[model samples]
Target: MKQSSTMRLSRLVFLYAAARLAVVAGCAGAAVAGVRLFGLEVSLTWVLLVGVLAGIAVSLLALRRLRTRINDEIRIVDNRRQDPSKRPRP
Candidate 1:
C-alpha cells in the first residue's frame, strides 16, 4: 500500500531539514577556507552566522515549493477517497 500523505509529508520535511544542515555546514567550511587561503581577516562567528541564516532562507523557499506540489497531490487523493463523485473529471 502507498504511504499516507501525512507520512510522505513527514519524510519530505525531514529531508528538507537535512539539506539545510548540509548547506549551512558547507557554507561555513567554505568561508573558513577562504579566510585561511587568502590571509583575510574575518570573524568566523559572523561567517557561520551568515551561513546559517542563508541556509534557513534557502530551506524555507524549498519547503514552500515542495509543500505546494505535495499538497496538490494530497488534495486530489483526499477528494477521490472522500467522495468519488467530487473528483474532477479527466
Candidate 2:
C-alpha cells in the first residue's frame, strides 16, 4: 500500500540521518582526542571542520548500501505517483 511505502521511506530517512550524525560525532570526538594525545594545539573550529569533512568521506564509502536502498525506494514511490494503476486503492 502507499501508506506502508511512505512509512518505510520515512523510517529509512530517519535511520540514515541518525547513522550520519553518529559518524560525524564519533569522528569529531576522535579528532579532539588525537589532538590531545599528540599534544598538538588546534582550534576547536578547525578540528570540528576536519571531523565533519572526514565523516562525509567515510559515510560515502560506508553507507553506500543504505544510500542505494533509499534511492531505490524513492524511485519506486515516484513511479507509483506517476502511474495511477500503481497507486493503491483506498
Candidate 3:
C-alpha cells in the first residue's frame, strides 16, 4: 500500500517537472512568435536571452510556491502536535 502511494506521488512529481519545462520552452516560443508576427529578423542572441530570462522567472516562482507549501505543512504538523487529545500519554 505504501509502495503504491509512493509510485503515484512520484508520477505526479515527474509530470509537474515536465510541465514546468514545457512552460519555459513555450515562453521562448512566444518571444519568437512575436518577432515573426512583426516580420522582424530572428536573432540567436535575442532568442537565447528571452528563453533564459523566462526560465529564470519560472524557476523563481516555483521555488517560492514550494517554500510556501512546505511552511504551511510545517504549521499544520506543529498544530497537530500541540493538540492535547492527539498527544500520546506517557
Report lDDT (CA) for all predictions.
Answer: 0.72, 0.88, 0.67
Q: Which candidate tops lDDT?
A: 2
**Residue lDDT tens for model 1, 1-90:** 987666776777677667767877776777777778999887888877877787677666756777676677677567767997865488
How far in Å is the alpha carbon of 63 misplaced in model 2? Answer: 0.5
TM-score of each model, paired residue for residue: 0.62, 0.91, 0.51
Clashes of 2: 0
lDDT of 1: 0.72
Clashing pairs in 3: none
Best by TM-score: 2
lDDT of 2 by residue, 1-90 (tens): 346777888899999999988988888889988998998889989998998889888887888899998998898889989999988799
Taking all chains together, the TM-score of candidate 3 against the true structure is 0.51
RMSD of each: 5.7, 1.9, 6.4
Higher TM-score: candidate 1 or 2? Answer: 2
| Candidate that beats the other on lDDT, 1 or 2, i.e. the better one | 2
